[model samples]
Target: MTFRPVKATSEGQFTIEGAGVNLYRAFGFHKPREFDPFLLFDDFRNDDPKKFEKGFPWHPHRGIETITYVLDGEVEHGDSLGNKGVLGKGSVQWMTAGSGIMHQEMPRGNAAGQMHGFQLWANLPSSLKMTAPRYQDIQGSDIPEIIDDDGTKVKIVTGSFWGKRGPVDGIAADPLYLDVSVPPNTRKVLPVDTYANTFAYIFAGSASFRDASTPYGVRVEKEVNGEEVNIRDMSGNRTLVNFDTGNEIVVNSGPDGVRFLLISGQPIKEPVAWHGPIVMNTREELMQAFNELNNGTFIKDQRDH
Candidate 1:
């Protein structure tokens, strides 16, 4: 197995969205193909209720799927189809806006006034863009966790990791999503599908993705030209590590250990014309969606098409 190297890294920036809720945006809204089959990812983690309690109000979505995973909070969600639910700690909700749908998510903190969670947007292919909408809600207990001999822990959310499969399924991208934690100073090599594009986002701690050329236990700094630059220093919290193609990933946990979300999927090599919350294959289709939305016909049941 070959270890995928980090090609690019990003420290998620602080952004406010959805009725004034403060959150960190990892990536979204531009350069769509880089995370193909996936559109956006946002992390909402805060200890102050004043920062997150406002929550997202009603919104429209079409031609994509939104996956919300809660770590320590409760999210009350309602959709135009009359579906409603609350996602509590460790729970996940996958909403498919195939044809079209309007929904709202309101977040509330725990008794301690702390909330943490993530929302990931995955794109649908043009063929399934206008299909019927649906939802798949997975309880916290339904998800599986795998523990390794080396003290590495993995929580599988989608696809097969190790020998265990995640609770959520029937996804078009066939993504592999894992919440992983490595023991301090331990090196763990995890397998990923060779054909899938992969990346990891560190949330809790720091770690180094395999720079195979560098021997383990050496300082993470790299020599560039004649100067020593700290390359792996960028792999800190809220850092997104974009990897090249490989069947496996090697992570060397720092002294404090490391926890991250390892996500991968097949790329959708199609043109993406996105506008606000709607995503289509072309600009004309995008304009049409906005037109229908403005004309009060954005809902699938109300559209003539």
Candidate 2:
């Protein structure tokens, strides 16, 4: 079995979004083609109400899908298509912004004002770029959690793994989004599709992605007993881990244990013209979307057809 090597390490930096809400942008708005099929990912986990209270206001999205997974708080969302709902703890909302749609997501923390969640953007193919918009809101209880004999738990969110299937289906990319937790010092090997592009985001604890060769253009550091062991010059919470082509991934956790999101999908290796929330195959199409939004006629209903 071939092992996917770590391509690079990126630390999520402080950024402001959604009406000045303080958050960390792990990846997006810069390198559009770095992760094919999957375009962007943001982790908005914060405890201070002042930092996230502003929340994401109304925005336009087209030719892509946005997946929002909440871990601790509630996210009230509404779209231009007259669809509105609330995503509580452990809930996930997969919205396909085909054609076009304007939406707003406001975060309301729990009683203690603690809010945490993630939003990932997946790119749609050219054929479905102008398809009708749709939504797949999956509750926390509906997601299947499989615990292995080795104490590794996987929350299947978008694809099948460990003999279970995820609720979000009919996706163009056929992605596998898994939330995995491995015991301390234990090793875990996850089986991924041989051809899919896979990557992991470390959020909870420290872990090492075992591979022989180091990835190009990525920063790597070693830790000894929770202390920085490599590159004493840099010490901070890292965000992203990109991987090379492979069918499996091996991970070894630190003393405090490890938790991360492993996401993989078939690459759509096509020309990408992205502008804000809209992504298209050509600049002309992107301009058309913007013009439609300016004209106040972006939403297109497919049910009528």
Candidate lDDT scores, in order, read 0.88, 0.84
Worst 10 residues of 2 by lDDT: 229-238
Clashes counted in candidate 1 amount to 0
Displacement of the residue 283 alpha carbon in candidate 1, Å: 1.1
TM-scores, in order shown?
0.93, 0.91
* Highest-lDDT candidate: 1
TM-score of candidate 2 on Cα atoms, chains taken together: 0.91
The stretch of ten residues in a row with the least summed lDDT in candidate 1 is 211-220
Q: Model 2 over residues 104-123: C-alpha lDDT tens digits?
A: 99998889999988899999
Supply candidate 1's per-residue lDDT for 249: 89
Model 1 ranges off by over 4 Å: 211-217, 220-234, 302-305
RMSD of candidates 1 onward, in order: 3.4, 4.3
lDDT of 1 by residue, 195-302 (tens): 787889899878887655664435646778988865444267899888888888888888789999999989988999898789899999888888988999888764
